[model samples]
Target chain A: MDRSQLLKGLLDIIVLRVLETEDGYGYQILRRLRAAGFDELGDASVYGTLRRLYRAGYLSTYVQPSESGPHRKYYALTEAGRKYLHQMREAWEDVSAKMRALFDIAENGTAEKGRA
Target chain B: MTDTPQKNTDIADYRIAVERHLADLPASIREDLLNGLEEHLAEVSADLKPGVPLSHLLGSPEAYARELRETAEFPRENAGDRFRRSMWRMADPSFAWARGTADKFTGSAGVGEVGEFGRTLRPAWWVLRGFIAAAVVTHIFIFGNDSLREAVLSTGFFGLLFIVAIALAFVWLSLRLGVRAQEWSRRSRRLVAASGIALVAVGMLTFSWVADGFVYYREPVVGYSTAHDVVDEGVSDVYVYDENGELLTGVYLFDQHGNPLYLGDPWSCDDGRVNNPFEQEEQESAVPDPFAATTEPPLDEGRYGYRYPLCPVVEESTGADDPEQPASEPSEEPADADPSDEPTETPSRTPTPDPSAAD
Candidate 1:
C-alpha cells in the first residue's frame, strides 16, 4: 500500500486542521505540511485540496497584496470547517485507540504462545 | 522578495503548462484550481537556490496537473478521454518543441511585441467571426441558389442593412458569450468552439466558390467559342493556293483580328476518298475494312493556325490536280467537268466547283 494513497483520504482533514489555527496562503500551508513530516506531499495536492475545500464552503479566500512578490491568496477556515475538523479529530482518535488495543492483544498472545 | 523578470516568466510558463493539461475541465473549475498558482510558484521560486531549474524541485508539470486533478476530485477519465490523452501524449513533444522554438524566435526577433499587439485585436476577430457567421447563415437559409458574393451584391440597400443588422446581433451575442464563457459548462463551451470551426469552414468554402465564379465570368468568351472548328460547315481540310495557280504548302492562315484561324478536323484525313471511319460507318452503309490503310493527315505544325494541304499523301500523289478531285468526287458529274474546264485554274476554283465539298 502506498503512503500517498493513505494520505489522500486524510488530506481534507489535514488541510482543514492547518487552516484552523490561522489563515495561510498556498505556499505557507504547503511549507507547514512539509515541516510536519509530510516530506512526500506534493505541492499540487495541497493547492487542489484548498480549492476543493473552498468550493465546498469549508474555506474562504482573500487576496493580500505583497510588497516583494505577487499578491497572495490566503485561505481561512470557515465555521463549518472547524466543526468538521472537530468531528474528524474524534473519528481519528477512536480508530487509533482501537488499532492500538488490537496491536497490544496480538503481541501478548504471541508472547504466551512462544512460552508454551 | 522581489524576483528577476526571468523568474517571473519561468513561473508563468510552468503555470500555463499546468493549465493546458487541465484544459478539458470547466473554465470555472480550472480557474479555481489555478487561482493562486502564480503566487504559489513565485513563493516556491523565492526559496529555491539561484540557477536551479524549477522542474528539478517541483517535478514535471504533467505530474503536478495530474496530482491536482486527482486531489480536487474532478471526474475520472473515461475511455474517450484516455484515448484523447494518449493521442495528445504522442503529439505533445513535437508540439512543445515547435512552440518553444517559435517563442524563442519571436522573443529574439521582437515579434513577441507583435504577438502582444495582435492579442489586443481579439475583439476585431470576434466581429469578423460574427460577419462570417451571418454570411454563411444567409447563404444557406436565404439565398441557396446564388453564390455568397452574388447574393450579397444582388441584395439591394435594405437587404444589405438587414444583413448588417443580423451581423451586429451576432456580434452582441458573441461578446456576451465571451464575457461569461468561464462560467459555462465544458460541454457548452465545446459546442460553441465546434460551431465556430464549422462557421469558418463554411465561410471559406462559399467565399472560394464565389471567387471562382467571379474568375469564370471575367474570362474571355472568344477562346471557348473558337476552340473547335471555326466554320461549322464540316470542312475537314483546308487547301490554300496563290495567284499563280500553285498549291501552297505550310501556309498559315489567320483571322482579321490577328487571332489564328483554326479550321477542320486537324487530325484525320476526311478528303472525299479517305473518309473518317466513324462518320462513314454512321452515314453510309459502308462497313470500313479494319485492315484497309486509312491515310493520316499531316500533323498541324502551327497548332493555332489552319495550315494548307491538310492531307500530304493526296497532295503528293495528284500534284496540282488533287484539289479538283476532292472537290468533284462528292458530285460524280462535276469530277469529269471540273478537270476539263480549269486544268490550270487557281486552286480557289476547286472550292466553288462543289459546294457540298465543305462537308
Candidate 2:
C-alpha cells in the first residue's frame, strides 16, 4: 500500500507525534520523515500541512532567528493535541484488530472448503 | 540576461505573480518561499528541452493568490460585514474628533451663569477698555490742538470703528462656523471671547465719534416758517448750509404743477421740510411749498392739522363744561343743531367716528 495515500489523513497526528519527541524546523522535520521512509512528502505539501495543523490549534509555533540564515518558526504540540492523538491511536488500533479477526474467520472457512 | 524584450516582459510578470504568492505567507515563511520559488524556476528553465512553453515552469497565479488570501483578514464585500470586521476602528482609540469637540464645551457658555456671565463680562470689559484707551488718547490728541482735534477725532473714531467692525465680522463668521468648539482648550476660548468683546466696544465708540463729527461739520441756517392753514401747492424757497453754518444756496420746492412754494434753506424752514438725510436731490428739490401763494387750489384741512380724528370738535363740547369729554360731544352735535339745517343722522357720518379711536 502506498503511504502517500494514508499520509494526508494522519499528517496532523504525525506532526504532533514528531514534535512530542523533539522540536525541529521544517527542513529538519522533512529530513527526519524521509529517513524514516516517507519520501513522497512534497516540501510545499509538508509546509502547507504544518500551517494548517497550527491554524487548527493542534500545534503552536514560535520563531527563533538564526545568525547565518533566516528565522524559522518551530511548531510544538499542546496538551489538547496530545489527548487527541492518543484517542485517534486507540480507535485506529481497535479497527485494525477487528478487521484482523474477520479475516481470520474467512481464512478458516476457505481452508475447510478445500479439505472437503 | 540574453532574453528578448518579450521574454523580459514575461519574466517580470512571472516575478510579480510569484511575489504576490509569497506575500500570503508569514514574513518568516515568505522570504524562504520567494528565494526557493525563484531557484526552482531557474533550475526548471535550465533543464527544459528546446521549444517548450515557459508556462509549464509555473503554477497558476490564482491558486497561489488563493493560498495567501486564506491567512490574512481581507476586507469583506458586504457593508455590514465590513463594518463588523473593523469594529476596533470605532473604539475610543479612533473616535477623537467627536470626543474633542464635546470635551471642549465643558467650561463654556451653557455651563452656568457665573462662567457664562464671566465670559460675557470679560468680552464687554475688554471692549470697554479698548474704547476708553482710544478715547483717552483721542482726548489728549484733540485737546492739545483744537484745530486738528476735529480731524483727529473724526479719523481716529472712524479708524477704531473700522477695526471693531472687522473684528465683529470675524467673530460672527467664526460663531457661524462653530469655531469655539474646535479649540482644544478653555484658555483659547477665553482669549477669543475677550478680544471679540473689546472689538464690539471699540466699534460702539467709533459710531459715537461719527455722530460727533456729523455735529461738528453740520451747518445751521435761519428763516423758519410754520405751516399755516393748508398752504396750497406751488414752488417754494429753501436755503442750504455748509459746515460753518453759512448759507450755501436757496433750494426750490415745487408742486406737481411745477409751481414753487416758500423758497429758502430746507434746514431753515420750519413749515418743516422732512428731515430725510437719505432723500435724493430730486425729492428735496421737488418738494412743494404748500404755503406759497399761487393760483393752484389749496390742500384740504386733513393734510394740515395735528390730527386725532377722535378729538372732540367745538360743537361736540358740552358747552365747555368738562373740556376732556369727547364721545358724548360729536354724537350729540346734530341733536343740538338747528334741525332744519341738519339732515338728521346720516348712516355714513355716525359710523365714520372710528370706535377704536374713541376707546
Candidate 3:
C-alpha cells in the first residue's frame, strides 16, 4: 500500500492527536511529526491538512509573536475537535481488533488444513 | 523569524505562483490564506539550507493551493461576482471603465448598497456611463440646439457615440493594464494624480458657461419657455417679461381653477433685452412701447397706445368680489398706463378697492 495514500485518511486524525497534547505552530508541528518517523510525509501537505482542520472547526489557531521568525500561528484542538478525536480513536481501535482477529483465524485454519 | 534576503525572495515567488492559481478565490479567503501561508513559509525557511526553492519544500504552488482550497470555506458565487463576470466577458475595457465609475457611486444617490450584487451593477452602469457621457458630449457638439425628436432618432449620432465609447474603453483598459503591469513608482503615480487634479480645476473654471446646456437637457422642455410667449408671438410690438424681467418664453399660466393656460412661446427679439427683474422697472415695463422695433416679420401697432394683452392673475380663492372686475382693470393698465389707481402691494389686491390704490 502507498504510504502517501494511507497518509491521506490518517492525516487529520494524526494532526489532531498531536495537537491534543499542546498547541504547536506550523514548522514546529512538521518537525515533531517527522521526528515521530513520518519520514516520507510531505511538508506542504501537512500544512494544508492543518489549515483544513482549523477551517473545519476541528482545530483553532492564534498568532504569537515569535523570537526567531515571523509571527507564528499555533494550532490546538477545540472542544469539538477533542470530541471528534475521541470518537475516531475508538472506531479505529474497534476496526483494528476485528482485522487482527480475522488474520489470526485465517492462519490457524490454514495450519489445520495442512495437518489434515 | 528573520528571513534572509534569498529566503524572502523565494517565499515571495512561491506566493505569487500560489496567488496566480488561487486568483478565483473570494478576496477574504485569498487574503487569509496568503497571510497565514506567509508566516508559515517564513518559519519553514529558517531551518532550510540557504538557496532551497520553496517549490522544493511545497511540491508545486498549484497543488499546494488546491489542497488549501479544499480545506477552506468557499462561499457560493454571488450575484455581484456573476454580474462582474458578465460585464467583463460581454464588453470589456469600456465596461471595465464603466465598472470603475459605478464603484464610485456604489452607496451614492439613494442606492441601497446590497453587498456584492449591488456592487456588480456599478461596473455595468459604469460601462453604460461611458456611453452616456459619449452621448452627452455628442449632444453638445452636434445636437445641442436640436429638437428632442431629431436627437433621439439620429442613428448616425448614436453610431458615433458607440464607436467613441468603444475606442475610449480600449485606451482606458490599455492604460490601466500598462500602469499595473509596469508597477509604476510612487513618484510617477503622483504625477498622474496631479494631472487629474489639474484637469478638474480647469473643468471647474469653465463649468458655468456649458453647465446651462447640461441642465437644459436634464430639465423638462416646459421649463425653457413661458405662457407670455404666446401673447408675444401674436403681437410684434408687444413683448412679455415675467415680473423678474426674464423675457418669459414658453411660460405656463394657470387660471384661478388651476386649469393650464397656454399663451405659446414669446417671439424672440433682439432689442429691449431685459435680463434681470430687479433691475430698473422703468425699462422693464411689459406694456407696449411705441419705439419697439420688430425683430421678426412686420407687426401692426394700435393707434391709441402701445397695445399689449393685459393678462391679469385672479385669486378668486380669497372670496373677493366678482374677480372679473379686478382681472379686467389690470389687463387695461398696459406698460405706460397710470399707476396712480393701481395698488402697489400684490397681496392687498384681494382686499383693497379703487380707494386703497389712492392711499
Candidate 4:
C-alpha cells in the first residue's frame, strides 16, 4: 500500500495506540508513525490534531519546560480515547471484510472469463 | 530497529515548535500541553545520542505531527456564547442615545427652520409685529398729540410703573398673538392677509385726519376759531346774532377811545349760498349741477343761507384803554333758537357762574 494514502483515517488510531503504550510528545509520536512507514505525514496536521484531541477530552495533556529552549507539550490517551479506538478498530474490520468480499466476486468472475 | 531514545536536544526543539504553534489556544490547554511535553522530553532525553537528531528517528517533524492530527478531538463550538458576546458589543449606550436624538430632531415638530412648529411661528411673528406697529402708529397719528398726551398723563406720572406694566402686557400679547398668527400663516389661503388688516387700520386713521381737516373744519360759512380765544380792548357792549341776523347773545367790549362801539351782533355774516371752500370746484361740479335743467334736485341737498355762521365784533377805530369783552360762551341750546335773549343794557353785577361748572 502507498503508506501516505492508507494512513488517512488510521493516524488517530495509530497515535492513540502509541500513546496507549506510553505517554509521548509530538516528535516521539512522529517517530512511531515514520517507523510504521507513513513518511508523508505533515507536522501541522499532527500538531493541530493533538490540540483538537486534547480539547475534545480524548487526550489529557501537560507541558514541561526545557533548559535548552522553550517548553514541550505531551499528550496521553484517556480511557475514553482507548475505548473509542477499540470501537473504531472493530468498525474498520467489518468494513474491510465487506470490501474484500466484493473484490473476491470480481476476481472470480474475471478468472472464469479467461478460461472461457 | 527504533528502540533508541530520542536526543534531549531534538526533543527540546520539537517542544518549542509545538508551544509556538499552539500559542493562541485556550490558556488551560496551552499550559497543560506545554507542561506535559516538557516532562516527556526529560524522560526521552537521558539515553539519547549526543549527536543523533530526533528528526532522523521520527522521519520528520511534519510527518510526526500529522500522524497526531487525525486522532485529536476538539471541543464543540459554543455558538450561543459567541452570539451573546456579539450582542453585548453591539449595545453601545452613547451611540444608541445619539441615534435617538437624531431621530427626534428629524421626526419631531419644530426645532429647525423647516420644521412645522418653527415654520408656523416665524412667519406669524413677522406678520404680528407688522400688524401691531401699523395699528399703534395709526392710533397715535389719528388721535394726534392732544389725546395721546391726555391718555398717557391720565395713566399716571410714574414712568417705570407704566413701562413695566406695558412691557408685561406686550410680552403676554406677543406670545399669544405670535403663536396664533403663526398657526394661521400655515393654514390661511393668503399668507399676506395680516398685511391687509394693518393697512386698513392705517387707512382709517388717515381718513380721520383728512376728513377733520378738509371736510369738518372747512364746512362753508361755519364759524372757525383756534382752541384758545383772546379778549380784545372791548366796547362796553357786545351782542351776537344768528344766521338769520337776529341778536343771539353778547358780552361788552370797550374801545381804547373809552367809547363803546355798538358793533352789530357778532354772530351775523353776509347771508347767501357760500360754496364749500374745502372742496375743489371740479369736485363740487361732479355732483349733478343744480343749475342743470335735467336735475331733479333733492330738498335736503340744496345750498342755503349762512348755516349758523359766527362773526367777531371790533371797534371801527384803534385806541388805548379799550376794555376787552369776554369771549362768547357756546350755548347748549339748539342752534336755531331765537336771539331774543340779548340784554341791551348793563345789568347789576352778580357773582358770575364758574365757567367750568356751567359746562
Off by over 4 Å in 3: B23-32, B66-359
DockQ computed for model 3 against the true two-chain complex using alpha carbons: 0.31
DockQ, Cα level, model 4? 0.14
Report the backbone clash tally of model 3.
19
lDDT of 3 by residue, B194-278 (tens): 6545544554554555787765443322322443443344532232332222231212232233333333332333443432212
| Residues B1-359 of candidate 4: C-alpha lDDT, one tens digit per residue | 12333454567787777566556656775575566655554544433556666565445544544443333335455888767755865886776777667658756643532345455566455545554554455346533678765666676766336544554564566566655654574546255455546655665765576676675333322322211121122321234433333333222222233222233222222332222222324423654333224222222211211111113222321212124322222232224342324333221111121234222
User: Per the 3 Å backbone cut-off, how many clashing residue pairs does candidate 1 have?
Assistant: 0
Task: Give a tens-digit lDDT track for model 1, residues B144-261.
Answer: 7566656666778977887788878988877676557647999887887688788798899977988877655433224424424333445556564333334444444444344444
Top TM-score hit: 1
* Model 1 chain B worst lDDT window (10 residues): B289-298
**Predictions' DockQ, in order:** 0.34, 0.02, 0.31, 0.14
The i-RMS of every model, in angstroms, reads 2.6, 9.1, 3.3, 8.3
lDDT of 3 by residue, A1-116 (tens): 98876776777778888899999998889889988988766666677778767765788989898786678889989997998799889988998899999999999999999999
Best by lDDT: 1
Candidate 1: segments with Cα more than 4 A from true spot: B74-359
C-alpha positional error of residue A90 in candidate 1 after TM-score superposition, expressed in Å: 1.7
Q: Report chain A TM-scores, every model.
A: 0.94, 0.79, 0.90, 0.82
Listed per model in order, the count of residue pairs whose N, CA or C atoms clash below 3 Å is 0, 20, 19, 37
For every candidate, C-alpha RMSD to the true structure in Å: 24.8, 28.9, 20.4, 30.3
DockQ of the two-chain complex in candidate 2: 0.02
What is candidate 2's local distance difference test score? 0.48
